[model samples]
Target chain A: AQSVSQHNHHVILSEAASLELGCNYSYGGTVNLFWYVQYPGQHLQLLLKYFSGDPLVKGIKGFEAEFIKSKFSFNLRKPSVQWSDTAEYFCAVTPSAGKSTFGDGTTLTVKP
Target chain B: GAGVSQSPSNKVTEKGKDVELRCDPISGHTALYWYRQRLGQGLEFLIYFQGNSAPDKSGLPSDRFSAERTGESVSTLTIQRTQQEDSAVYLCASSAEQGTKNIQYFGAGTRLSVL
Candidate 1:
């Protein structure tokens, strides 16, 4: 079974601050990675995904993630965050033939 | 007409009663999935249906939890003799294909409260 690990449970930052959320997964085969975000009362939305392109994948709202196979990590990053960026973020991975596995999630609070 | 849809946005049931949750996938989609989101917990895979073939029920937590899909349109997840622990947000998502790379469109979810 594949497992996902998120290094931080909650993160607080002021506006315009750089952000990085660590994510690691345990899977040896070909895998697809994704980051999803959920606002306080909204449905989960895809932030970004890595299928077969470059290691660094960019997503909506100025979010990006880098896939490092050797480290088994796909960490999410943003150069500067806004107050509206406060939300809960989840990292998920899916093997070629299995269902997607998600990390516990990291809550980001960007204060103005 | 746009995304996956789930019925009964909220449900409250007695511990010993049975409850059924419904999901309507987007038109033309061939793959549908069911997931559970407990409070403060990540989404847990429950089941997956690919077209008219037998569904992948490997992620179902226990025998008490079962799901069914009709054709390629609607799916129903049934909880037999629901318990308090069964309370959670049941989410439904659908994709165009069976591969892991396909993007999944999710519904707002059905919040089930088993008391």
Candidate 2:
């Protein structure tokens, strides 16, 4: 079965700090990757996605992710994270002809 | 609706009782998916509905769980003889279609508690 692994369960940082959330998936086929964020009281929303084209994709707010095909990773990165960025981030991956699989999720806490 | 909408928002039922959760996908969406999120856990895929047919239901834990969709708009997930372990948030998502339009829009979710 395909699975996504998010190494960190939680991360804490002060405002303006750089952030990186690690995500790796176990699919060997042509895959599509995505990053979804869920705010404290809001539903899960798309942060970014990678289907094809550039390996580096930018998303809503100031979030961005790099799709490293060789490493099977799509890590989310932010140069300066704010308190408003505090939320649970999920990494999802789906094969070209398969259902999507989500990681356990990483809770990011940005302190002011 | 403008976005995916799930009914009840919260449901509490006793063990052995049956509970039905409803999901109204965004208009024009042809793909609907159901997931379960246990406390401190990731989203667990439950079922997928393409139009009115469920092509993939491999994530259903057991026979106690079943889901059906009405055409391509609404879907209902039913839990029979609910167990305490069934307590979790049921989420519904819909997307326009496969391929380049696979980005899914999620709902607020229905939090189910089986005591």
Candidate 3:
């Protein structure tokens, strides 16, 4: 069974601090990657997605992820985060079949 | 219509009782999916519906769980004799089609508590 691993469970940082959330999936076949974010009381929204193209993909709200096929990792990164960026981030992957497998999720708290 | 909508935002049921959760996908969505999110855990895939194809039951945790989708419009997930372990938020999502590139829009979710 394919699975996603998110190493960071929770992370606290001050405003303007750089952020990186590690995500790795265990699937040998071709796959699509996505990053979804949920605010305090909002539904999960797509932040970014990677189907096929350049390894680097940019998402909404100043976020970007690099898909490293060799490492089987697609980590979310932001050069600087704002206080409003506080939310739960989830990494998900799906093969051509369309069933997505998600990681445990990483809770990011950006303090001002 | 605008987005995926789930009925009975919160459901409280006693153990051994059966409960039904509903989901209304977008107007023209061709794919619908159900997922369970336990507290502090990632979303677990439950069942999937794509157009007229037979629904995928591979992700269902047990036989007591079943889901039905009328065409590509609405879906209902039924839990028979629910247990405390079944306590979790049930989320519904819909996409344009059954493929990796299609983006899925999610609903607020139905919080189910089996007492």
Every model's TM-score: 0.97, 0.98, 0.98
Candidate 1, position A109, lDDT: 98
Q: Which is the winner by DockQ between candidate 1 and candidate 3?
A: 3
Q: Which candidate is the best by DockQ?
A: 3
Candidate 1 local Cα displacement, residue A23, angstroms: 0.7
Clashing pairs in 3: none
Q: What lDDT score is found at residue A71 in candidate 3?
A: 100
Task: Classify candidate 2 by CAPRI docking class.
Answer: medium
DockQ of all models, two decimals each: 0.81, 0.70, 0.84
Candidate 2 chain A TM is 0.99
Candidate 3 structure quality by residue, lDDT tens digits, B5-113: 9998999999999999999999999999999999999999999888899988888999999999998788999999999999999999999956778788999999999
lDDT of 1 by residue, B42-110 (tens): 889999999878899999999999999989899999999999999999999999977888788889999
Residue B82 in model 1: lDDT: 98
Cα distance off (Å), candidate 2, residue B77: 0.2
Each candidate's lDDT (Cα)? Answer: 0.94, 0.94, 0.95
Q: Is the docking of candidate 1 incorrect, acceptable, medium or high quality?
A: high
Cα-based lDDT at residue B15, candidate 2: 100
Runs in model 2 deviating more than 4 A are B52-54, B99-101
Error of 3 at B41 (Å): 0.8
Q: Which regions of candidate 1 deviate over 4 angstroms?
A: none
Model 3 root mean square deviation, Cα atoms: 0.8
Q: Give the range where candidate 2 chain B is weakest over 10 consecutive residues by summed lDDT.
A: B48-57
